[model samples]
Target chain A: MIPNTMKLFVGILRPEKFQLILASGIKYFAPPKNYDDIEIPERQRLRIYDKVPLYPSNLKPPKMQKRLRYMRGPELLHNKLQLKQYGVMATGGGRLRHEHFEMVRLQVARRLDMKRMFAIWRVDPPWQPVTKKGQGQRMGGGKGAIDHYVTPVKAGRIIFEVSGKCEYKEVYDMLRIIAERLPFKAIPVSQDIMEKMAADEKWQEENNLNKYTLKYIIQNNMGGCHRFISKYDHKWYGKYV
Target chain B: MSFIKKGLLQSPVPLMVAKRFRGKINVQKPRKPHFEKQLLIDISKPYYGPPKNSLPEITLCENINKKSYKREIDNPFERILAKECLDWFNTSKMVVFLHVNSISMEDKTPVFAALKKNDMHLRTYGKKIVSMATKGTRYEVINQLFTSHQNIIFGQPENAGKMFKILRKAPQLVVMGGIVEDRLISKNDLVEYSKLPSLDIVRSQLCSVLQSAGSCLVGQLNQNQQMLVSHLEKHIEIQNNPTNSDNLDTNAKSES
Candidate 1:
């Protein structure tokens, strides 16, 4: 039989009352809600334009004289490094509009899980602002109000890089579809293809074909007379011409 | 009357017992809180140390007749550059050399920037190839080249082909080497190289071949078991039906 004093003590310290005190203490000291638990607002997802936009007319596009001619050619230097497993290169040169870029972005994003796999834009979207006069207005008195801005793409420019937890073969057709939608002649190229092309070019020149080839003459259109004297030919002899 | 008297007596005793217990029990005393001094550690300071050497000492030969030269890569940074080249060469099955002649610095800037950006992207996927302007002596010794022209080397055979396609577009840069299959190939050979499928495609093709072979063996092994099971079922059917066995005996007798 239990002592009368002990029985009285046990009766005072009931399990239910002790548990209630512990719960209240824990409620007071529990860590604040985790940062990751905070819910993002729906309004933040909406697109918002910048407060002030720059005028495209005010800025000057770099004079790309020599570079412009090579735009339609294979990308020579830029994007030479195989930064991604799969990439889309613009084979044909033309102006790329904002809508076109957005469409391509949406198409790629829809196909690829944007979380595991993502794309890096090689070309910048047109940020220059172009204002226009009313449609019925007559021809320009001063410079006509600027039309919409555009990004001028030369051939051989890499459009975008797709990478991360994605296989090249799986994304090949998807990328091809995106390339078809692009205004310029765009093609899907992997790191291997690019490297092979570079190697072939190097091999040709090493054998002296690049220095004295009929293809060079036909491509450059230096008729038979100027075939020997290329524009790159240096005048080793003193200028006694 | 006795039951009512017992209940009334018990209730009064409990009340007196509770009063007596309250007097005997001592309440718990509150503890004084103790504060500890906090130690603040600074982690923002950057650590500095001597540069690490990354390049391995190896002899790269240019041709059969030509003697192999030992390249002098003295600086730690130079070793890093050499190491990058070596890494690309060893990892890639194909390596390419290019001679960029007469392009002005202004024009080269954008090209360099693009190459650098692409390099960063490639590094992420472990397909990155290094492209650095050849410092005549240093690069030539390492790459086993004879040209004095401004050159660039793209390493990693898997990616070397793609770089080849892009390089082909630049009519100005002359390709100097196409190393593969343990021998140097001529310009015409590059066209053949370009026609080949990428490494991933080849790997997938090989995997499919192996998978088909495995599946064929599994099917062959399963064929005998299936035949045996069917034979056993036919035998059991004959044993179960006496009329079918008698019909079979009559057919055999008629044939004879």
Candidate 2:
């Protein structure tokens, strides 16, 4: 049987829907939403971030290796939210510069209703030093001078979170903008959306009809594919880059 | 002489000489200045810049991702109170909104007592409760009056005159407006309505006015028959006694 709402649309188009109206069931309208539980925190805006990490004047800024592992495979830590409400989650691996941090900060500050909603950074500020040589210089003597800084992010890593009395719709646009502008693929997700995605992924895995799935193939190392793929592919079953 | 003349016109010579001497540096060692420690306040200021990409417009279909569920989060107490207030709206013939200033319990008690004595109730409800009670009802227009502390006096329309009398004694409760007999009226209109006489008295007065017109018509209709009877009786009296005819004739002349 058709819902009563459908007959309303049909009636609008036909204007003579007495027969259709007689066929439909009774309509019960949805009640309004209640926001009794949502408590706005003391502060309801993105916190200010330092341009660079604090370093003592006496000690020179420390240098480190490329550590390509940091940006490969899915993030094992900082993947879940500290204050779960809504946030931008990275879908691919990449590095975020200080400029990206400023972009996210400014966009959140501009759009967030400070009285009802607040946003916070989940990823650290730009702290990894990136080395670079002079523009026209030949091969660098020893290691090149440390130039700028960046924050390495991997798949499933939450870049920032917004919480408080606001619904996901209030911050969706701002989070989506930040996610799109990031170096790698990312998506805006609320806590419910994240949980649903996880449940769907598990359901798909459990209900797979195919005998030869990617996880199965990777785990069994069928056709000797281990030689061609990197250790990350073996570890994550080729799910994340 | 030329130098003296220039000095006289432009500058005082003795003062210029003093200025040149004053330019000499101090030869004595300067005293040590006191020092104070500086406090460094680290304020993490927000950075604003040109966004690399523009934000997409808010689309209507965005809520499709969210799962809808029935919310049963209404407060039970508020729900009951709202229902009770709705009953007040339905049953009462008049609802007068009064603005309550800052009044202590002692000052407020007498006003409440007076209203209670006259079969009127003075009630105060929160803005939320009032809005919930008035929502989608004929009494919804009174929702705007709930901006500040407000009291509602509910009673019959006839008792409005008595209500106004009691309210006049209490300076705290100022009648803003009210709904009387289902019609919304202002404070002045309410006062004017209260000044009107009771319904029964007005009805009786109208009945007397209506009956007087028919009574006057009946009196006019019987006047001709009554005059004929009186004239015949006087003629009989004159026929029985001829000596009394002169006295009767004088009476008839007066009558004519």
**Predictions' DockQ, in order:** 0.01, 0.01
Tens-digit lDDT track of model 1 for A70-153: 233334455543454678887666556677777777777668755445566777666443456677888776554546655656
Give the fraction of reference interface contacts each candidate recovers: 0.00, 0.00
Model 1 residue A184 CA deviation in Å: 0.7
For candidate 2, list the clashing residue pairs, or say none: none
Total backbone collisions for each predicted model: 28, 0
Q: Write one digit per residue (lDDT tens) for candidate 1, span B175-214.
A: 7666564456755676567677887898999999999999
Worst 10 residues of 2 chain A by lDDT: A19-28
Model 2: residues >4 Å from true position, as ranges? Answer: A1-39, B1-256
What overall lDDT, based on C-alpha atoms, would model 2 receive against the true structure? Answer: 0.77
The lDDT per prediction is 0.54, 0.77
Q: Which candidate tops DockQ?
A: 2
Q: lDDT per residue, candidate 2, B131-243, as tens digits? A: 88989987887888886446899899999999988887788888899999899999999999999899999899899999998898999998998899999998897788986
Sliding window of 10 residues with minimal summed lDDT for model 1 chain A: A232-241
Runs in model 1 deviating more than 4 A are A1-77, A127-140, A203-241, B1-256
